[model samples]
Target: MNVSTASARVPEGWREVNRAMWDERVPVHVAGSFYDLDGFRTRRDDLRDFEKAEVGDVTGKSLLHLQCHIGTDTLSWIHHGAARVVGLDFSAPAVEAARALAADLGHGPERAAFVTGDVYDAAETVPEPSYDIVYTGLGALCWLPDIRRWAETAASLVKPGGFLYLAEFHPFTEALDDATGTRIVRDYFSRGAQVWDEPGTYADQDAVTVNNRSVEWQHTLGDVVSALAAAGLRIEFLHEHDVSLFPRFDNFEVRDGYHRFPEDHPRIPLIYSLKAAKS
Candidate 1:
C-alpha cells in the first residue's frame, strides 16, 4: 500500500497507526530482556564498535538523536562522552519510558533530555540553533513515507560544520524474506509503503499476541544519499557491513551481540552507515 491508501484508512492516518503500535510495544520492550534493561542499569554504554569508530569522539558535543526509541543508544552516547544529548520520538509512551529509564540510571536533565515529536516536525518541536551532531538509529528510515522530508528535517537540525550520521538496515536486506531470509521476497526499489500485520516484534517473538499493524517504506542507498545532498549536506563516507546488530533473518547466528551469516553463505550487505556534514 501507499501513503495515499494509508491516509484514506483512518483519521490522522499512517502516523497514527504507527504511533499506536509503538505505544503498545513500549511496555513489552521495557520488561523484555531483549533491550537488556538489567544490563543497562549497570553499564552506561549501549553503542557498538562501528558507531564509535565512525562518529568518533562526541566529547563535549551537543548531540541530537532522531527516532531514538527508548533512548538506549541515545544514553549510550552520553557514556561515550557527549556533553549533552536530546532524544526525540513520535511515541509518547516511549518518551515517558525513556525519561524514567534515564532518571533511574542517574541521568538528570542536565545530561540527557527526551522529547515526544514526529521526526518530520522536529524543527518546530525541538530547540533551534541546531546541534553539533544529528544521529539516526537503525530501523528508523523505513517507518517514514518520505525520505526527502526526513533528510531535510535532519539537515535542518545540524549546525554548519556539524554532521548527520545514520546506521540503518540495508534496502537489500529488506528485500529478503523475514523467515528464512535467504530468498529475495520483496522489491528493493519499492516507493510505496508495505502494510504489515504481525504479532509481537523483533525484540521478542512470543511476548505478546496483539495484532501489531504498521506501515513501512523501502528506501534505496541512492535515495538516502541524494536526499542528504539535496538538503545541502556533503557526503563524507558510506559503508556497508556484513553483520547486523539484530537477527533480521533466520539464517543469522547471534554472536558478540551481533547477528552474522554463516561463512559459507553468500556475502551481502545487511547494514549500512553514512556520515554527511553540513558545509
Candidate 2:
C-alpha cells in the first residue's frame, strides 16, 4: 500500500506538529495516574506481563525500545535484568521526562539512555546489528502512516538471532467508536482512506486543544505479520488477549489494571502481542 499521500508527509511541518502535540502531553501524562511513576519504580513488571512472557530472558542483553513514550516500559526491562537499554522517541519533552525518571529511580545513564528522533530516523542513527532486543509497547503503531518502513527499520536495528517484541491494541478494536458511547462505528477491513481529525488524546481526558489533526493508518493482523515476515523476521509467537490495558469500550470496566467487556458481551480480541526473531 502506498503510504505517501497529501496528508502523510515526513516534511518539516508534519514533524513540527507531532513534536508540539507530544510536548503538550508529556507533562500531563507524567503527572497523570495512568503512568504511575511510583508503581513503575516499585512494580516494574506490572505493566509488561505480555512482554515478560513472550520476550523471555533478557539478562545481559542490549535492548532498544522504539516510540518509548516516557521510557516507563524500557526502564521496566532494566529492572527485569536487561544489561543495557536505549529508549528512542520523536518527542523532546517525552525523552526529557524519561531521562529524569531514569535518574530519579537510580537506573542511571549507565543502564538506560534516551534518544529523541523519528522512529525511522533513529533506526539509522542507532547502531545496527547491536541490540539484542527491539521492543515497543501499546498505542504506538497507529501513529505511523506506514507499516512496511516500520518493520524494515525494526529488522535493521536487531542483531542476527535477536528478536523484536510488540504488544499493541488489536486492529479490530480500532474499528469501534471510542467516542460514540455506544457500539462499533468504523470499518474492520478498510484498506483505503485514513482516519483524521481527532481532538484530545487517549491518555488525558481534560487536555483538549486545536492541535488534534493526526493522520492514522489501520492495518489488519495479516498485514502486520506479512510485513514483518517479508522483512526477514521469523515469527516466534502471536498471542491475543481478551483484556485490554486501557478502557477501550465505553461500557467496559477496569478491574485489576485491565479493562474487559462483560462476560455476555461480544467476544472480540482487544490486544495482541507478537514475538519475532531475526535469524
Candidate 3:
C-alpha cells in the first residue's frame, strides 16, 4: 500500500516525518552489521532472549505485528510456525523492503502480508478481533503519542481469547541521556513532552540531513499497564529485564546478543515485556 498520502493524517506532522526517517533508515538498517540478515535466515531465534521466553509457542496462530519496521521480527514469527502473519507499518519504503525479503524467502501472501498504514488507521483497513496474537517489539511505543489509543487498537485486533505481547524499552531508561555519556538529563517520572532534533535514526550513526525536528511522549510503567487494563484487557504477565536487545546506553557491554550496563550501573530496568489477554 502507498502510504505517502496517509502520512498527511498523522498528528503534529509525525507521519510524514517518521516516514522520511524510516525510509532513509531502511537501507542503512538492511546493511547494518547489527541486523545480520544472513544469520537471521539460518536461525529462527535471532531476537532477544526475553522475546523467545515471553512470546512462546506461536505455532498455527494468527499474529498481527504492529509498527513492524522492515518486518524482520514478524517474519521470524512465521519461521517459528505462525499460520499467518500480517505486518503493519507507516513507512512505505520499509514495507517494500519487507515484501522483498519475504519474496526472497519464498513466502507468499497466503502465509504473510505487509501493509503500510498508520497504527491508528490499521483497524479500519484490516479485520479486527481476527488475530490470536497482537505483537509489537522494542522501540515501537515511543513513536506513538497516545498509549490509550494504542491499547484500544490492540484490544480490537485480538480475538476473545487472544493475547497482546509487547517488549519495549522501559520508561525509566528513556529518562536517561545516553548520548552525552555523562549524566541523567531528564526526569524519570515526568510525563512531559520531549522534542528531538534528529537528522538520523537510532540504528544509523552516519546519516545526517537537514530535516531534523520531531516530538515524542514519555509514559511511565504505570501508564502503560493502566491504559491496557482500562481498554478491557486482562494482564497475564509483566516481566522486566536488566538487559536489552541492543546497546541502549553508552557504557553498556554487548554479550551474546544482549546489552548490559556496567557492573556498578544502577539497577533500573532497561527493557520490559508484557502479555495481556482480552476477556
Candidate 4:
C-alpha cells in the first residue's frame, strides 16, 4: 500500500508488472478481511487439513517457503512446530508485511525470517543453501514462466532426503469457462503468455487500483510432474482433490471446508498436490 506504481509493463516485463501489482496490494490485503489478520493472531496457524496431513510433521525441521506472499502461512509453519522458517518473495512490501506480522507474533528473525527475492533466484538469494523441507503452494506455479526452471530452483533448495511439497489450484480450471466451469474457453496446453487486463485484486474485485495488467502462464499437471522429475527430484505422489478453498466458479458450492461442484455435477480435479523428494 505504501508502494507507488503506474509503470508500463512493456518496459519492465511480467515479473515487474506482477511485482508492482502485489506490492500495491500488500496494504489492501493486510487490512482486508480476506486474510483475517486478527483471527490469525488469536489462533495457531495450521495449513489446510489435507496439506497438514500430507506434509506430516515439521517439528524442529528447517523449512523454506517459496513465493511466500505475506508470510502468513510462513509463520504458520513455525506454529506447526518447525524449528525455523524462512519466507521468500519478490515483493518487498509483502516481505515487510510478513516480517511485521512475524514480530507481532513474537517470532524474532532467528526463528522466522523473510527475504525479498525473485523465485528464480531463490537458490542463491536465501541465506541457507538448502533446507530440510522446501514448500511451494497456494497458486505459485502460474506466476512462473518456466516450470522447468522453477522446479530446478526449488529442487536445488531441498536438502537430500528432504522433499518439495506443492498444493496448487488445478491448471485444468484454466481451460474451463468461468461461469459454469464446464465449457472449454482456452487451450489447455498452450505455452503462450495469457495477458489479463483487469482491475482490482482477487481479495477485493471492486477495489480501486492502478497496477491492473497481469500476465500469467498455465502449466498442466503433467508439465509440473515432468519438470520436477527432470530437475532430479523423484516423484513421490500426486493427488488431486475435488475441492478448493476459494470459490473458483459460479456453480461451486461450499461443502465442509472447501468449495465443490454440486453433488450431481461430476467431480473434477479442482486442486492438486504433490511431493517430490531429492534422493
Best by TM-score: 4
Candidate 3 clashing pairs, residues 3+ apart or interchain:
none
The estimated TM-scores of all candidates read: 0.93, 0.89, 0.89, 0.94
Give candidate 1 misplaced runs (Cα > 4 Å).
1-12, 178-182, 209-211
Model 3 scores worst on lDDT over the 10 consecutive residues at 1-10
lDDT (C-alpha) at residue 82 in model 4 = 97
Ten contiguous residues minimizing lDDT sum, candidate 2: 1-10
For model 2, name the residue pairs that clash.
Answer: none
Q: Write the per-residue lDDT of candidate 3 for residues 58-158, one digit (tens) a residue.
A: 89999999998888898999988999999999888888888887887889978889988899888876544469999999888877778899999888899
- Which 10-residue window of candidate 1 scores lowest in summed lDDT? 1-10
Point out where model 4 deviates above 4 Å: 1-12
Q: Pairs clashing in candidate 4?
A: none
Per-residue lDDT of 85-111 in model 2, one digit per residue for the tens? 999999889999999999988877778
Writing each residue's lDDT as its tens digit, candidate 1 over 1-279 gives: 112222323234778888888999999899998888889888877887998999998999999999999999999998888998999999999999899999998889878899999999999887655999999989999898889999999999999999999999888987787766788877777677667777787788776756477877778999999999999999999999988977777778876778988778787898899999987
Whole-model lDDT per candidate: 0.87, 0.79, 0.79, 0.87
Model 4 Cα displacement at 231 (Å)?
Answer: 0.8
lDDT of 1: 0.87
User: Listing every candidate in turn, what is its Cα RMSD in Å to the true structure after a full C-alpha superposition?
Assistant: 2.9, 3.9, 5.0, 4.0
Model 1 residue 142 lDDT score:
87
**Count of backbone clashes, every candidate in sequence:** 0, 0, 0, 0
Candidate 3 wrong stretches, greater than 4 Å: 1-11, 127-129, 177-184
lDDT sort, best first: 4, 1, 2, 3
- Cand. 3 Cα-lDDT: 0.79
